[model samples]
Target: MLEIRGLHAWYGDSHVLHGLAMDIPRGRVVSLLGRNGAGKSATMRTIMGLLGKATGEINCNGVNLLKLRPDQIARKGIALCPEDRGIFPSLTVTENLFLPPVVAAGGMDIASIYALFPNIRERGASRGTQLSGGEQQMLAIARILRTGARLLLLDEPTEGLAPVIVQQIARVIREIKELGYTVLLVEQKAHFVESLADIHYLIENGTIVDRLESAEFAASRDRVERLLAV
Candidate 1:
């Protein structure tokens, strides 16, 4: 549902992404696999208009987002859950979640979000800082879901998360996929994405260098290992 082509991004005088191109098909989860500094997160940030200057085409469900601002990109049904997990530390869990205006139809109600994250439901009155890392991550994802965003940009969702919490996040991702949301996932944990993604794109330098569909992964496991090692 999202298409990117010839995309480049800059932060002041520093250029990060260069002519990166990729596509996220509808109702499917695609993982961006790469080592650190491979521009996986930069791709996500550029797609979400988080960078100061972005050029080229970023069309979401046919709407061009490269020319849009960060908030404008969000209103077009795209949401980014950054690695840092942005949350309002001063606000209560419930308050932080409902703060962003729902820009589209089908935003999840409180019951629905709470159902996916039971821990969050229980700590509805607690301040954001009072939650654990996992809980904070849940809150971040849930907040975006409430915006009724059709596309989700999840950057390193399992980074530094405990094994059990990673499993929980993986399960929730599967559930989210089944609900028809499109996801572009960035992850270094190959095993975590094994059963979840339909396609895996290997990035290097600043662009997609290779890709393996689900059927090709088992046969090409060694090549993928070598590619990531580069």
Candidate 2:
């Protein structure tokens, strides 16, 4: 549902992405797997128009994303859940869930979001600061789902979470995918990506070095792991 071509972005004088390109098909999970500083997060930022200086093409189903403002980009059926989660510290879970204006018509309602994230439902009255890291992550994802965004840009959703919580997050992602959402995931955990993503893009130095389907990833497991190993 999204296509990026020759995308270059700059944070002030620091040019990060260098001709990055990828394709995200409808209802499939595409992952950008890279080491730290490899521009994975920058790619996400550029797609969402969060970067001030981004060039080249970021097309969402033929809509030129680069020309739009960040809010406008979001209104075009895209939502980002950054590494920090971006939760309001003072807002309760229910309040946070309702904070973002629904950009389109397909967003999950409160009942559906609660059903997908039971933990969040249980903590509906808890403030963001009162939640644990995993709870915060779940809330972040839940909050975005209520925005009616068809494309989700998730940055490091599994990072720093407990194994069980990671599993829960993965389950949620799978459920969303089954429900026809397209995901552009920026992740470092290879095993997690391997299990969840349909195709993987290996990025380094702000460019995609290799692209692998799931079967290819299995065949080249050693090489891919070596590149990902820190």
Candidate 3:
């Protein structure tokens, strides 16, 4: 559903993402695994057109994402849930959920989103500041699901969360995959991605160093660990 080639991005004079290339098939969960400075989040920003200076092809289906503005790219059915879950401190959970405009057809209704995130449903009247980190993360994901975005760019969804919350996040991704949404996952934890991602692309110094299907992961476990180690 998504294809990227020769992608390079810059923030003012600082350059990042050195000719990165990867593909995400429709309805599949693909992961980019890398260290802190490995350009994982940069790639996500570039794809979403949030990066200022980017060159190269970011094709979604037949549409050229590089030519479109961030809002336009979103209207074409792509959504980014950044590492920091962007919830409004003053808004209630229900208000936050209804804030983003629906960009396309076939978005999940409030009932469906509520069903997927029962915790959120239970706390519909609570302000964002009243929620726990896990609840906030769930709301972030839920907010985008209402936008009818087919391709989800989840940047480090599991970062800094407790083990149980991480598992819940994983489960949510799995459920969305089963529902036919394509996902581009950026994560540092290979273990967190093991059972969820269909393909894993290891990145180093802003480029792809290796690609592994889920089947090859068992054999490449040690190599993946070494590369991820600080």
lDDT of 3 by residue, 1-230 (tens): 88889988998888998998999999999999998899998999998899999998988878879999999998888999999888898999999999999997888898889889999989999999999999999999999999999999999998889999999999999999999999999998989999899999999998999999999998998999999998
Which whole-number lDDT from 0 to 100 does residue 216 have in model 2?
A: 81
Q: Estimate each model's TM-score.
A: 0.94, 0.98, 0.98
Estimate every model's Cα lDDT from 0 to 1: 0.87, 0.91, 0.92
In Å, residue 216's CA in model 2 sits off its true spot by: 1.2
Q: Which ten residues in a row have the lowest lDDT in candidate 1?
A: 221-230
lDDT of 1: 0.87
Q: Which residue pairs does candidate 3 place in steric collision?
A: none
- As a TM-score, model 1 comes out at 0.94
Write down the RMSD of candidate 2 (Cα, Å): 0.9
TM-score (C-alpha, index-matched) for candidate 3: 0.98
What's the residue-level lDDT of 226 in candidate 3?
A: 90
Candidate 1 or 3, higher lDDT?
Answer: 3
Off by over 4 Å in 2: none
Model 3 deviation from the true structure expressed as Cα RMSD, one decimal place: 0.8
